[model samples]
Target: MQPTILITGATGGIGIALARLLKDHAQLVLLGRNPQKLTSLQTEFPEARTEALPLTDAQAVQALIETLPALDAVVHCAGEVVLSSIQDSQLEDWESMYQSNVLTALVLTQQALPQLRASRGKVVFVNSGAGLRASPGWGGYAASKFALKALADALRQEEPLISVTTVYPGRTATDMQKQVRDMEHAEYQPEKYVRAEDVAQAIKTVLDMQRPSVIEELSIRPG
Candidate 1:
């Protein structure tokens, strides 16, 4: 049987790119917040299962996980980026970033632990370079991603049965990046950033590694 893989943020650029690559290699379970996008992706890949629900809704996420069969891997690509300096950032912005970037991943991974352990599954977190270092206008976003990095590290240590890989990619050409650029009042240049498909390829490499030798962290930067 093909390995069953779950991808969060299925509607986003990197997530969608990953889906297109993995469709033939695995049985996909695509989860995203947008119903229309999920339906669109489902139509494109009829063999894959699709779920449209807010990742922050813990109970709903748990329920969804309970219905799935043995899972072979989970690729966490859901995240949010808000640009605000420490003095300018509001509590609401911090909360929103935390909920989207860290809390959702925590809740979903906790819910999927059983299935993952049973299959010795791999967990790939699509992190950002912001998680590594904070910039002038990225305080809240960086904090959330830092928390996510911590979670990934803790999970790697605690869950020996499941391999965990955290990927930190530099600026990517995605809608989210466009939003970030708008917030920064910088020019939106897609060509200068990394391609979402390239990041997806890096994730594919992580999942394809040989047993007993796992990549704990992967950092990708545009050339």
Candidate 2:
């Protein structure tokens, strides 16, 4: 049987690209906040299951997990990026980033633990370069990603049967990157950033790894 892979942020640029790559080979469960986009993706990949809901809702995520069959992998792509310097950042901005980037992954992973353990599955986190090193005017977003890295580390240690891979991609060419550039009044040059398809391909490679051979972390930057 083909592996069942669950993808969060299924409507986003990287999420959509990754889904397109895996849909033909895997049983997919696409989760996102937009009902219309989820429906559209479901329509496009008729064999896949789609859920339109907030990933941060613990109860909702648990309920959704209960409905799923055994899963072979989960790709967490849902996150937020709010650019602000430490001095100028508001508590609300930090809170929002924490909830979206960190809490969502935590809750979803916790809820899916049972199924994952059963399959000796893989967990992939699509993190940012900021998680490794924070740059100027990116304090809030970077802090949240740092927490996500910590979470991934803890999960890897706690779940010995499951494989965990954290990918840090530098400035991917996505709508979110455009928003970040607009916030900084910088030039929005998609060519300068990593392509979403490249990130997806890296993920595919990691998922293809066999037991006793695992990639713990991967960092990808634009050429």
Candidate 3:
């Protein structure tokens, strides 16, 4: 049987790229918020199951977890980014980023732990370079990503059998990166940024890693 992998943020650039890359060979459960986009993608990847909902709701996540009979991996790419100096950052933006970046992963992973343990699965967190270091206007988004790193680190130590990998991709050419560029008043040059498919390919490498070893963390910057 093909390995079953559940990927969040399925409608996003990197998410869609990864789905296309894996759909032919893997069983995919793609979770995202945009119903129309999810429906559209379902048509393209007819074999993949699509779920449309907010990941912040623990109850909804719990229900989803119960429906999965078997799962081999989970790739968390669902997250939000906000740009602001420490002095100008809004309380709500910080909270929203935390909920989107950290809490969603927590709820989804917590509910799926049983299946993960049973399968000795892999957990991949799609983090950002901001997670490693903060810039002047990146405090809020950076903090949330940093918290996500902490979550990945703890999961690794606690679930030794289940491989946990955190992938930090630098400024991928996604809509989110365009938004960041707009906020920064810089020209949005998609060619100047890393390619989304490259990030997706890197993730495929992580999942292909075998027993007796695991990729703990990977960081990619534009070449």
**Local accuracy by lDDT, each model:** 0.92, 0.93, 0.93
TM-score of 2: 0.98
Tens digit of per-residue lDDT, candidate 2, span 56-82: 788998898888778999999998888
The TM-score between candidate 3 and the true structure equals 0.98
Could you tell me the C-alpha RMSD of candidate 3 in Å? 0.8
- What tens digits encode model 3's per-residue C-alpha lDDT throughout 1-223? 8999999999987898899899987999999888898989899888888999668788888888888889999999999988999999999999999999999999899988999999999999999999999989999999999999999999999998799999999999998999999999999999988999999999999999998689999999998
User: Candidate 1 residues 1-223, lDDT tens each?
Assistant: 9999999998888999999999999999998888888889989989999998777778998888888877999999998887887988899999998999998999899989999999999999999999999989888999999999999999999999999999999999999999989998999899999999999999999988878999999999989
For model 3, the stretches where C-alpha displacement exceeds 4 angstroms are none
Residue 56 shift from truth in candidate 2, angstroms: 2.3
What lDDT is obtained when candidate 1 is compared to the true structure?
Answer: 0.92
Regions more than 4 Å wrong, model 1: none
